[model samples]
Target: MTGAADLLSRLVEEVNPSSAWRDSFIRIPRHRFIPDRIWVEDGDDLAVLDRVDDPDAWLRSCYADRPVVTQVDDGDTTGRGYRSSSASMPSIVAMMLDATDLAAGQRVLEIGTGTGWNAALLADRVGAGNVTSVEIDPAVAAQAEEALGGFGVHVVLGDGEKGYPPGAPYDRVLATAAVQHVPYPWVEQTRTGGRIVTPWGTSFHNGTLLRLRVGEDGTASGRFGGNAGFMWVRGQRTPHGTLDGRVRPDHEYAETSTDLHPYEPVGDFEATFAIGLRVPGMKDLVVFDGDVPGNPHYTVYLMDPGSGSWASWRIRPGPRDYRVRQHGPRRLFDELAGAYTWWQEAGRPAHSRFGVTVTCRGQRVWLDDPGNPVSPEDPV
Candidate 1:
């Protein structure tokens, strides 16, 4: 047996890193951050696999730099349904660590404790006393606290939106949760000129790493990095209560309008920067299989919560304008296209050029640089 230490070393090399990050990677063992039984994809639902059943797979998964799904919906719901939680993918974690630029003795606040692996990594470099993490689930928080007890890293159980105010004025705040908007608490908790990096987006799968610096005025602004996916923080879940209708099975009534866009052929609907801009910060972004390109039927969905809207679009090669079926406070596609045009006129820069703001109401959304104020029409 090569042992866990050997595994850690192997991962550090495979994941590729500079000397300091490499050392920190090896110092923090991933297996300790996982439970004996964790969540797995069981067909459509997430199911638990007792580690004993596939110890090698578990070992590989933990070491592979991919975030493993730990407890789906906190183990209460059947693992076969929709997924609600995960340990997070490894490359994603690497992206965050890279963005954070954590150094020894720097005080860091991690929003989603997960299994505490990242926390351990931060503690390894910054010293346990310098790192404090928060997890919304008390059970998850308690588990993390116990796992990290020896390291002395403070893991608090509370709504991550609230942050750890007592920690007051952190040098860096790293959040694993995907935010619809940058919360005010993060700005308040971070020291002026401090860095705050998080998965900033409106959708679940289509979010980017937002790196910002808190201003003297308690506002944060920065650009987007590479893309990352994260679970929506508990409080951020928009109340989807009392829906009037289900997704129209036929999808025949859907439409698309580009009054603002200059009319260009769309390719890889899921990968376009324009599409991302249009559908920014959607809690869910996915590619479903009902039609392949060049087929008779092809469609994708861009859903938004804040406006209680969903847009179903498809490519039929008939005409540019199709009737759009709208629902909720905001017609989702309209917002996406509007945001897209806004990005286009600005020279179509990558996310890094954009900045983020944690408004007073605690919305953690990303916006274009030369930001829009929290006005009555469109607050942060």
Candidate 2:
């Protein structure tokens, strides 16, 4: 088998070919950043690979394009719960760097210092002195620091949400973790024409990337990049609460029938994103009929963690109108339908066509231009 250096060389050449950051890939060894005891997906379970036990396997995993799980459930719960932090996939990392449009001697602020691999790359691309990374977990930061060793990249053990204020007015801010909302502090800390390459999405969907450009007025607006999934930031993680604890299972619901198959439209990226903007603070779950494989009949449940409002839409296998049963103040299905119609009328724009603007006030998603908000016809 080829050594780490050979693998890294091939990875850069074949997977991610960036002339600017090619030297970074050649210089920095990814294996050094990865911990000995890492998690790898094994069938339906997560198996820990100890470097001492299987050096070759561990080295292969480190050099692979896939992400290696560093911490699970905030380093508390074992097995497979939630991946708190990870060494993100190399391809996506390369894509993010390309999105940043990094230039030499430009100061960069990295939101999450997971394994410090990306920070090392950033440091190599634009001098180590120009890179600053923030990690919420102290242990993760310590590990990253040790891996970075004398690299001169400042790894601050602080909340990524706040960003590194001491290193303010950065040329670019690259967030490794996904966030529900764009942190206003990031916008404030960036230069007028600075760019922010981060994964931004809602509870409805967790696969959208936003490459925002900071405006002169302390606001940032940019188009959505391709689909990129990452774990939510520590502070912005959604709480998983039982339905019985929040709302009554037998609660009376308002019945309504729609011609639209709730899943078909709601499952779409553009439609779901628009619906998420219209209906905030809601989590979605699609429950199939049984544990049987390849079940067609399923019910989509939309729950608002804040308000205890819930809605469920049942869909049959055949061509039948979906039944929507919603409870509480907010009619989720109705709102979703309206939002879907709104998206349709706007020419069914792709996720790339949509853009989001973040300011001290709040974030507003728009289509084509910032002047045109997504909810133009029906304002939420």
Candidate 3:
């Protein structure tokens, strides 16, 4: 049976975390925080991985570097398979921890303590009493609180977006969940010069890690770095829908043909990241025709649930012009294509090149530097 040490070895080789966090990774057993009945992706649904049924596979999953689904559809079994909470990828957990640049005795406030493993790791580094974690889900929080009981870690049940004001002036604030906007309360709770690390993304993109340094003047600013696509916070989640429900045959649409393909805009990470910034509230999905292996026939759907708008771009083995269909108020395909063109015109800057400055007023995403604002100030 593989143990935590084996997982640590794999993480060290794959992520190569700094020397500061190597010991914490070694000390925290990830399996202890994970539930016995975890969820793994099985086709379009989530399949349960029972520890009693298959202990080996379950243990392997717990130690794997991949994200482990802890809850689905907000713990509603009857609902569609929506991954609500998860134990983040091991490497990403290491990367985000490294980004905190934490030191012993520093007060840390962690948001979205999914499985309490990260909180335990933080406690291991900064002393259990100095770490305070907030989780929104009741069951998840109760389980985490129990797991962390002996560690002296304080687990609060409340909205993480508001942060825990009682633990004010935290030296470091780490958010396990992703957010569309950096909540002002996180900045307010951190002391000046302290760090706030969280996954920031848009409806179109899940996101990248954002490391911000709180300024003396009550604001936080930093650049986007590392590939950290995490689940969105409950409050900022994008509307979930099925393609069949959103795209109906009875719905009226505008038919057109586009020479541009969805390869770069949809497939390329950098392109999709940039395009997501420009086209807000746009979500995408690619559906393959039939169940044939290596089938090139597929359709890319760009949907904006806010305006009941959707666009379908068909892709096949051949043909220069692909069938394009737009429905409802907004023209999603054109917007995506325009955003892609704009990204190209701007020399195709990587997502890391972009940065964000958050103030009492709102948040603004900038490219290259804070002096140049890429988009209009996003009001909080």
Q: RMSD to native for every prediction?
A: 4.4, 2.8, 1.5
Q: Candidate 2 lDDT, tens digit per residue, 1-380?
A: 77888888877776664777777877888898999989889865678789999999999899888999988878876443577889999888888888999988999999999999999999988886999999999889999999999788999999988988899989999999998788889999999999999998887878688999999888888999788889988888778676566558678899887667865466777678767767777888777788444478887888888777888888787667778889988887777777778777878778888888888877878878988886433221
* Candidate 3 regions with alpha-carbon error over 4 angstroms: 1-15, 291-294
Q: Estimate each model's TM-score.
A: 0.80, 0.91, 0.96
Question: Could you give the candidate ranking by lDDT, starting with the highest?
Answer: 3, 2, 1
Cα lDDT computed for each candidate against the true fold: 0.67, 0.84, 0.90
2 or 3, which is superior by lDDT? 3
Which candidate order results from sorting by TM-score in descending order? 3, 2, 1
Model 1 Cα lDDT, one tens digit per residue, 1-380: 45677787777777876666777776677788788777665555556677899887777767766667777655575433444556777667777888898778899999989788888888888886999899987778877887887887898888888889888779999999887667778888998889999886544334677788888887777777787867777776544422224354543343545433223213322234444444544533334445243454445455565554666565345556544455555566676566555655756655555455555644333345344431221243
lDDT, candidate 3, equals 0.90
Residue clash pairs of candidate 3: none
lDDT of each residue in 153-188, candidate 3, tens digit only: 999999999999998989999999999889999999
Model 1 scores a C-alpha lDDT of: 0.67
Task: Identify the runs in model 2 with alpha carbons over 4 angstroms from their true place.
Answer: 43-45, 78-80, 242-248, 375-380
Best of the two (1, 2) by lDDT: 2
